[model samples]
Structure formats: C-alpha cells, structure tokens
Target: MSSAAIFVNIFALSCLVISLIKDRAKTKQSLLVAVKSFFRILPIVLIIIIFIGLLLGFVPLDLISKTMGEQAGFGGVILIASVGAILHIPALIAFPLAASLLKGGASVAAVAAFITTLTMIGTVTLPLEIKELGKKMALLRNGVSFIFAIIIALIMGMML
Candidate 1:
C-alpha cells in the first residue's frame, strides 16, 4: 500500500481507539454503521473493478492513446469529462482508473477532467438533487461545477 494509505489507516485506528475509550457503545454503533455501509456499496465496487479490468484488458492501447492522447487536445478532454459526468462510479475507483489511463498515454488534461467531473458532477443523482434543492439550484450547481472542472483540467494540463 502507499504511504498515504498507511497513514490514513493508522490515523483511523488511533481514532477508533480513542472513541472506544471515550464511549464503547457509540464506537460499536459507529463500527456497525461503517460495516453496513461497506457491505451496501461492495457490489457496486466489485462491478466497477471488473469493468475497469475489462476496459484495460480488452481495449487497445493505440486506440486509447489516439483518442485521449496529447494530439486529441481540448475535444478529448471534453469528451472524457462528459463520460465522467455521466458515469456513476465511486471516486475511490475513479482515481485508479484515471491513473491507468494516464499510464496508457491519455493526456493529463483528459484524465484530470475525467476525475474532476466524475467526483463533482453527479448526473445520476440530479433528480434527487433537484427534488431536495429545487431545479434552479441543482442546475446552477451542476452547470458551474462542469465549467470549473474544465477550467481546473486546463490549468492542471498547463502546470503538469
């Protein structure tokens, strides 16, 4: 595992210990909730992993590079960003997928845009967001997020 993963695990362990000491019942309840959430999301996680594996295994590297490479330019970034916004994969899986694409010759801008839109713009949850926050607010938030995602991707491409 990466150092960051190790550090996060250690930190979480420390927090659990402290929580247990302060309130055993609450800590136990929190642990149960965490486990339940994990199980609830496990199927989707597995599906995402399998899909990513299949994508990497079956898709030609040359095709991926040709579509998402430096030559693909801003159009490629927009295309990937749109895909990211449409797909409902969890952010935890999205990062590694983005990394794999980057390794396979995808442009930094495209990968960045994909990650940004995947995390920030939730097209899958739009109906619920509109129900909860009203249509205007939901549309504004998603629209501005999409714009900002593109801007951030462009900036990252320039820097990196």
Candidate 2:
C-alpha cells in the first residue's frame, strides 16, 4: 500500500483508540452505527463490483477505445457524460470504472465528464428532487450542472 494510505490507517486507529479511552459507551455506540451503515450499503457495493467485473470482462477493448478514445473527441465526452448522468451508480464505484476506462484507452475528457456528471447531475433522482425542491429549482440545478460538467471536461482535456 501507499505511504499515504498507511498513514491514514494509523491515524484512524489512533483516533479510535483515543475515542475508546475517552468514552467507552460512546465509542461502542459509534462502532455499532458504523457497522450498521456498512451493512446497509454492502449490497449496493457488491452489485457495483459485479457489474464492473462483467463490464470489463465482456466488453471488447476495441469497442471501448473506439467510442471513448482520443479520436472520439468532444462528442464522445458528451455521450459519456449523458450516460453517467442517466446511470445511478454510486460515486465510489464510478471511480474504479472510470480508471478502468482510462486504462482501456478512453480519453481523459470522457472520463472526467463521466465522473463530473455522474456525481453532480442526477437524472435518475430528478423526479424526487423536483418533488422535494420544486420543479424550477431542480431543473435549473441539473441544467447548470450539465453545462458546467462539459466545460470542466473540456478544460481538463486541454490541461492534461
């Protein structure tokens, strides 16, 4: 593992120990809460892992490269962004998938756009957002997010 990861682990362990020393009951309660949250999200995590494995295993490299590679240009970035916006995958899962795509010859712009739109814009949750936040606000937020995601992708492409 990287030194940064090791340092984080050490820091977390130290914090846990300090918390336990300061308040045993509260620490126990916090651990219980953490475990419950992990279990609640476990199924989704497994599903994402399975889907990613299947995607990488079955999809042809040539096809992936053809659609998302350097040659695919701005249109490809927009296409990936739209796909990302529509898909309901969690951000944690999206990173590995994006990395895999990059390794498979996808352009940085396409990957960046995918990640940006996936996290920022939520087409799948639009109905709920509209219901809770009102139609105008929801639409405006999503529309602006979509435009900005494209701009960010273009800038990333230029810089990197």
Q: What's the count of clashing pairs in each model shown? A: 0, 0
lDDT of 2: 0.91
- Error of model 1, residue 65, in angstroms: 1.5
Give lDDT: candidate 2, residue 140: 98
Structure candidate 1, residue pairs in collision: none
All candidates' TM-scores?
Answer: 0.91, 0.85
Model 1's lDDT to the true fold? Answer: 0.92
Q: Candidate 1 lDDT, tens digit per residue, 10-107?
A: 99999999999999999999999999989988997788778778878899888888898888999999999999999998888788789879877899
Q: TM-score of the candidate numbered 1? A: 0.91
**Residue 57 CA error for candidate 1 (Å)?**
2.3
* TM-score of predicted structure 2: 0.85
Off-target runs (Cα >4 Å) in candidate 2 are none
**Per-residue alpha-carbon lDDT of model 2 for 1-160, expressed as tens digits?**
9898899999989999999999999999999998998898889888877877887788898788889988999889989999999998878778878988997789999999999999999988999999999999999999999999999999998999
